[model samples]
Target: MSTEPDDIVARITEIVAAELGVPAEGLAPETDLRGIEGADSVRLLRVVAKVEQVWDVELDDADVFGVSSVADLSAVVASALQVKA
Candidate 1:
């Protein structure tokens, strides 16, 4: 897959870190989001909401739910940004 914009990835990582109570530095592209400590559907959705707010873009539920890791989420965000642009 192609790389996403650095700014988009950075902001997405920041939102995930803030909402999930995980340090941004601890998250990696292959990190399993659902496997993260204290992570649940609710918390994950909160992260998604925060991302939407931060980027002023909406994400599809299918795409959000289908994402299993940080990199997948970043890809979804990048696609959304491309559509918006």
Candidate 2:
């Protein structure tokens, strides 16, 4: 299954929001994941894990930790999917 960049961002926003216990509607593509009120290392990692699960791709540790905003993560996921393809 192929996921478009916008779809990746939306799904990731949902995952991050769920993990951080915030409303998904409150998140924007430019929103920094680390800046979220309840965001912590473990919670952010969970979001990464969920993204990996949903997309069935393994993101590099460097890429995962390097991402700050939802858009950044979406770009990384798009790159990973490209590599997989």
Candidate 3:
């Protein structure tokens, strides 16, 4: 996996955009997932699933539930990568 933050964020943004059908350009690291139109648990789970797939890391349900934005999830991903490393 790339260690660069921009690369990680870009890939994550793409994954989120594809899963949520939101415009990638409109999403920021702080954008609230729950506030997005049409966002639901199932769809949000799919986003988590996709992130796991991309990083090959399994996230805890508690961590997943507490995340409110991409930046939070990205931080979890970073921690997972550190542990995996």
Output the better candidate (1/3) by lDDT. 3
| Candidate 3 structure quality by residue, lDDT tens digits, 1-85 | 6745677777888888998898999899999988888789999999999989888999889999999998888888888888888
**lDDT tens digits, residue span 1-85, model 2:** 4488878888888888889999999999999888999889999999899889999999999999999999999999999999998
Best by TM-score: 2
Model 2 vs truth, CA RMSD = 1.0
Q: Which ten residues in a row have the lowest lDDT in candidate 2?
A: 1-10
Q: Candidate 2 has what TM-score? A: 0.95
Give each model's whole-structure lDDT: 0.82, 0.91, 0.86
Q: List the residue pairs that clash in candidate 1.
A: none
* Model 3 ranges with Cα > 4 A deviation: none
Judged by lDDT relative to the true structure, which candidate is superior, 1 or 2?
2
In order of appearance, the predictions have TM-scores of 0.86, 0.95, 0.93
Which of candidates 1 and 2 reaches a greater TM-score?
2
Weakest 10 consecutive residues, lDDT, candidate 1? 1-10
Residues 13-64 of candidate 1 have per-residue lDDT tens digits of: 7777888898999987778989988899999999888878777789999999
